[model samples]
Target: MNIDKITRTNPENMPAPVGQYTHITRIPRNAELFVTSGQIGADHNGLFPESLNEQVTNTFNNIKTVLESERLDAEHIIKVNVWATEKIDWDFLYAEWGQLFSTDYPAMTIGYITALGLPEIKIEIELWAAKV
Candidate 1:
């Protein structure tokens, strides 16, 4: 018997995801689960950058660090959630993000709003990854 994958998705007739993620995800009953805390734009020394692009880069780097600990790479990510204090520069974000993944891009959702935990921080990104 083949086990079905659990995925969360809106109606195909509905509009596509606005940002980086689908409202749904698919998982196997026996799949290994990995949960990452919301990653902020802080460095090892707790340094927060002022520039939006810098913060986005650092945020991705922070996620990479977490993924590396599990012997996983960016391509392994299946779902992602991003939060930003202001509107993101998708072009800038893509420029930096494109350097990490080759072809397989993960499902993602990016939310832009007013504030984050730290005032200096402009963005926070979290992700879920699994081997397909």
Candidate 2:
């Protein structure tokens, strides 16, 4: 199956979405659409870790878990958005990102902010993936 018409644009250029979502995605009507809830730095046991690196790692792992549940993988992802409580350590996040995604990196957005739901939690990631 082919994913149709995936598009991303600067918010300044388009009408903003009605909710927390940032963009309007247009795709083939027949293609299945997958939406994932915000994945935080929580483990399978629903525990949030204290370290930033550990939190980021768990966030990505949680994303992977959701993708796997839909019979998808990182390669199938088309877009990604990340929210972090602290200023992101670019080097660290990039290194961790390399472990999950090879050269086929998806469209990504990352925001560094003051806080998250829990003070100890460091990151939240959500993404869109489509089948090839």
Candidate 3:
């Protein structure tokens, strides 16, 4: 895929995105879309970290692993949905996010929730991707 086949736009009619993401991602026709189960703060070894920062980091690492397993990278990402049990460390998360997406940001939605699938899981991220 050339990557240009995916289009992202932040409409002038609406306020700018609150974070480092676009409002819309238009996928080309005939593109293949992939969806993943919510990725939690668990490592490949099934170890869950104790701290929020470590959990968040592990979550991102898990996301990357899932993407790679599907033969996709951040470029193939169309949307990212994040759910957190507590306030996120934006500086830390943005750093990880930047490393993953670089400048090719995709549409995203984030929410602060009360709990997740597990007690130790501080955050979960679900990804939507496409390839043309």
Best by TM-score: 3
Better of 2 and 3 by lDDT: 3
Candidate 1 lDDT by residue in tens digits, 16-118: 6665445556676676777788888887889987888888888888888899899988656777788998888999988767877664456777788798887
Model 3 whole-model lDDT (C-alpha atoms): 0.90
1-132: candidate 3 lDDT, tens digit per residue: 444499998899999888999998999878999999999888889999887789888888889889999899989999999999989889999998988987878999999999999888889999999988
lDDT of 2 by residue, 1-132 (tens): 354645434458776543223353444556566778778988889898878888888888887788888998765676788888877777777777887777546666778888778776788888877663
Task: Give the whole-model CA lDDT for all candidates, comma-separated.
Answer: 0.76, 0.72, 0.90
Q: CA RMSD for every model?
A: 3.1, 6.0, 2.5
Stretches off by above 4 angstroms in model 1 are 1-25
Q: Which candidate comes out best when scored by lDDT? A: 3
> Which stretches in model 2 have alpha-carbon errors above 4 Å?
1-29
- Candidate 1: pairs in clash: 7-25, 8-24, 8-25, 20-108, 21-108, 21-109
Question: Which ranking of candidates, highest lDDT first?
Answer: 3, 1, 2
Better of 2 and 3 by TM-score: 3
Give the Cα error of residue 87 in candidate 2, in Å.
1.8
Model 1, CA-based lDDT: 0.76
Clashes of 3: 0
Per-model TM-score versus the true fold? 0.79, 0.73, 0.94
